[model samples]
Target: MGEARYSRQIPLIGEEGQERLGRSSVAVVGLGGIGSPLSLLVAAAGVGRIRLVDWDLVELSNLNRQILYTSRDLMRPKPFVAAERISLLNPRVEVEVVHEPLVPGNADSIVEGVDLVLDALDSLEARLALGDACQRAGAPHTYAAVQGLFGLVTLIVPGETPCLRCILPERPREEPAFTVGPVPALVASVSASEAIRILSGRGPSLAGRMLVVDLSSPSFEFIELSGECPHRPPEPPPRPAYFRRGDRLYAFEADPSGWERLERRGWAVVEESDAYVRLSGPGSVAVFYSDGGALLVGSRGEGDFREAVGGDLEDL
Candidate 1:
């Protein structure tokens, strides 16, 4: 509730870091094995708000490893039950429950404002969709998976660390796998710790690497990872001058000095580097290149471009 609630950890991470947790928000998608403990740990660490996303109901089978539920909570919505347990543990953390799976339709909105989204999902397809959304929105994602006595955890920082699709281009079979309570418990602990580290301004431990845990052999392995992210919105037919390619919806022919022109109008330059210059305004995260091309990734970004140019977007 106050400094006293986090006093023990404050000495370890300092008051500034503790306050950082209180100001940050995170979403834990999936309320099963890993999500249960991970969400609790984050809340106990004083994370300000947590969004619980899962579409499953409590089942007796899930009680074996899902620490958040018991026989009494059977058949209840996982998110709502998780929220109640979270409230009992720490009333200060605001909890929001979503009774839906993460898919392309809702992925973008799910990642909108959260500082981080931790993946406890058991579905590979959903994981990829979430990864795509997080990468596009520039949000941090922590991924964890458990099978049998083994599991892995990694932190994906958009534009930095490789996205999930980059690491796994092909979806693996979704065959049933075996898992024990200890395996998921350990993995979720690490997953929560990683989330806390990022929220508290200490950054992530698995930024460019993946931690592979095998409780069977009592081995903790760190595997290095490097790859270019290949997730991008699908291209559609160009509407006159606007073209879609890779991660950008852009205008092929633009004024190299157009940023200044837009700046004179209203757009503000947010980032500039050797590759391109970025502009921020009402409806786009746009970038301009030396070759007079404008890259936009937002929904109405093309409209913004058309208005800024003071003309219709026509063929180059």
Candidate 2:
């Protein structure tokens, strides 16, 4: 390859960094709004290999945000079109197309051998599944989503940072949402930058923090999350101590000071009884028992109690 191809970025990241990027592999798990521009940028950055995964054919309406697909691409499978376009952008990069939706059964295979995973999914459930798959594969993933003019991006480094399940424990079960053109492209650029930084070790990554963008208010917010994730193994359970309610999980804690500890960490005591002391927070609920048993519950569609507590409690 010619130095002129990377003449601009090399000054900032150095030739060594450019070469490092050439040796890395990444997976872009979606080919719509965010995924489209994200895949293009990832290839243009000179990443050695990229796996493009998406099952849907490009629809005419997607043209507004999915820049990788043109009017001619309508009715074409996204992965194939994306692979073709990305290949043309950087023939030096190997582009692999997976014309399938990412389900739990196939997510691991998609993430396997990839140095990074770029999650550009709109569905919260698919993002959750991809997060779990990355956890299982021990791959770092940059997750971003856009809904209308608002979007968020975060980087998860398998065991080192919180996974999506930790960041958002409860699965959102809403109908498909709307998004504009520039919103996803902006978030996707951030996601691509995180991937480049991680691959080249050139800049700071958003491993444990979230970047929230609200174009409506024209504001950007960065939030640091408590470093906890489902990938960490849960400690052994105490007799009949773990259970679940709906999407929320419940667990009995034997520590008398557990409630106190939670209170110190911002959990508010909401209700109490000889048998139970219930505590509440923005996204979780906890119940303490006089018999040294406690129950922790997750908020529906918001957060997960099990991930917060580092427990294995799941829906019954």
Top TM-score hit: 1
- Can you list the residue pairs that collide in candidate 1? 148-178
Worst 10-residue lDDT window for candidate 2 reads 233-242
Compared with the true structure, all predictions reach lDDT values of 0.77, 0.75
Model 2 per-residue lDDT tens digits across residues 88-139: 8889999887755565556778889988889988777667778877887788
Q: When superposed on Cα atoms, how far off is each prediction in RMSD?
A: 15.6, 17.8
- Error at 138, model 1, angstroms: 0.7
Query: What TM-score should be assigned to candidate 1?
Result: 0.73
- Candidate 1 per-residue lDDT over residues 1-316, each given as its tens digit: 2367887898878888988998999999998998898888998999999999975557687988999998987645577789989999999899987655566667787777889999998878778878888877889898899998999999999888888887787878886657989988898999988887888888788998999998878999999988766667442222233444223345444666666766676778876755456676666555555555554444554556567555554421
Clashes of each: 1, 2
lDDT (Cα) of model 1: 0.77
Q: Find the 10 residues in a row with the least total lDDT in model 1.
A: 233-242
